[model samples]
Target: MPAITAENQLALPRIERPGPESRPRPAWLVTTARTQLEGEGFQVRRPFPGLEVGIADPFLLLDHIGAVEYAPGEAKGAPWHPHRGFETVTYMIDGALEHHDSTGGGGYIADGATQWMTAGAGILHDEVPPAWLVQKGGLFHGVQLWVNLPASMKWSPPRYQDIGARAVTLLASFDGGALVRLIAGELGGHRGPGVTFTPITLAHVTLAPGTRLETPWRRDFNALVYALNGRGRAGEERRPFGEGQLVVFGNGDHLVVEADELQDARSPNLDVLVLGGRPIREPVVFHGPFVMNSREEIVQAIRDYHAGRMGHIPPTRMDFSHLVGEHIDQDRGGTRR
Candidate 1:
């Protein structure tokens, strides 16, 4: 899905309102980054819709675990849980996470890998540190995004896409100062590896100091940029966003980003994940793990889970000694593959 590109140099034009005559640059709305605990026990920063901030349609939630070193036996993950009417996309920057689902689909996503699970109708799953990693201490870092499914596709068949690090498409700048990994949808002109039921764009971007890039996007889609490391700016105001910060854009067909030149040489670049999608604009009823158009559908989902309709996961022996050192990349640095 490579699109046409001119010189790598880019600039952000003045804001223009979207109308029949012109499509303006989207402005930075607000930043909503907060720390919270999820699943069994893991601290993460969340910035996706709430009482203060409106939900970025199609993207229900985004939980980012920037980078955390885990001591042996200190890491915990999501226990067996049920989900419906949405998909869970897990992109691992470092460390390893073993996922087992009721559909008998189980696997491990190591550094730079991604696991996209569609809990269409319903499914039970558990995301836990690998048995081997739990036994031996290591670092754990990643983000889990919850994507909303339209009412029509809410009951579709559950599916999964285990995208290896190498499967992702990478685009580079002319000077090699910036790299963009397309996870879903097209970035620049390059197509991403994973696909979504609804139209959306998901990309991991890394920019060296003073690097600038503009990503084309749908004018109707809602968008946001999440800073994973270092600092950066977006839009005309050049609103600064730092690690664990989320910057939501107003409306525009292009996303402008520039890496800040900080004094610290250790983090010489900025790492960010850009996400956007055409707003479903449909009624949303979210109840815990279930997301439906109406309260009735949410109740039905709870009933379905309790009725054991979503298959069951088979038990496996706890001995993971034989699997140590498999499918892992020791150097988990860098933005993504």
Candidate 2:
């Protein structure tokens, strides 16, 4: 196989959502489980609920948030947060999220949209529930990823991209199932959208029961899979994984996931998020959301954020003075003697 580079990568085509399969799980088998959070939100049982499964080499953190209801005027969503030395990806499965940043970038992402932001240097942003979405009160589902920036790009400029769902290409499917290739790199001979400073792959896949999906991955890159919904077996171990759980794989050249035919109708659709990247072998100094190589660098980031040197604040005229009170309480709660 040829090496995947920026110039030679193939764009994966867009695919439609597959129909439900016949062999649904037994009604008493408990197809979907529900987990609730007090201030954060709720998550429907899918791949790996809250546990961090999957490869730990290059990827740092992954959080699958919401597939649940968000009441109107709810201030329980993620408030203003800071990030540095890594890229954060927000892919929405349902509903939408309104995003605002200190860099004057603001937008609302609906279902199936993908937001890839590079916090190479430093960034402060907020992901809040939009007013229109609050009125609907439907399902608000999505996934957030933290991909470590390589040492070379750790101090690069901060950037953001909002990829519409229609723009994402679909790659060929195996065993009559389909896959959606999103940001970063490519899979199954299909390239993903969004330019990546470092070589990485992020894909959303849905497989029907009795189907098998095989992907060729770089041997040097670390890889892992998070099952969003349904049940399946992955890798050579054939470990049984349900929704809201992750399956971390050891070093390998490729990965194979097989959906069992025994899965019932309610459990016919198996959704997963795939991530892989080359590891950066360097010391990581993390303080809250800001990640840098040393404590001095982190202190510098804090200074910049306070000094108004990072970027201009958005001019939306929205009053955010109340957030200062919340930040003060958070600092007191997290402070060390």
The numbered model that scores best in TM-score is: 1
Candidate 2 residue lDDT tens string, 234-283 = 76566677677666666555776767667656456677787777767767
Q: Which residues of candidate 2, in runs, are more than 4 Å off?
A: 1-55, 73-75, 264-267, 328-337
lDDT of 1 by residue, 157-193 (tens): 9998999887877676544566777788866566787
Global lDDT of each candidate: 0.73, 0.63
- TM-score of every model? 0.84, 0.80
* Candidate 1, residue 154: lDDT: 91
Query: What lDDT would candidate 1 get against the real structure?
Result: 0.73
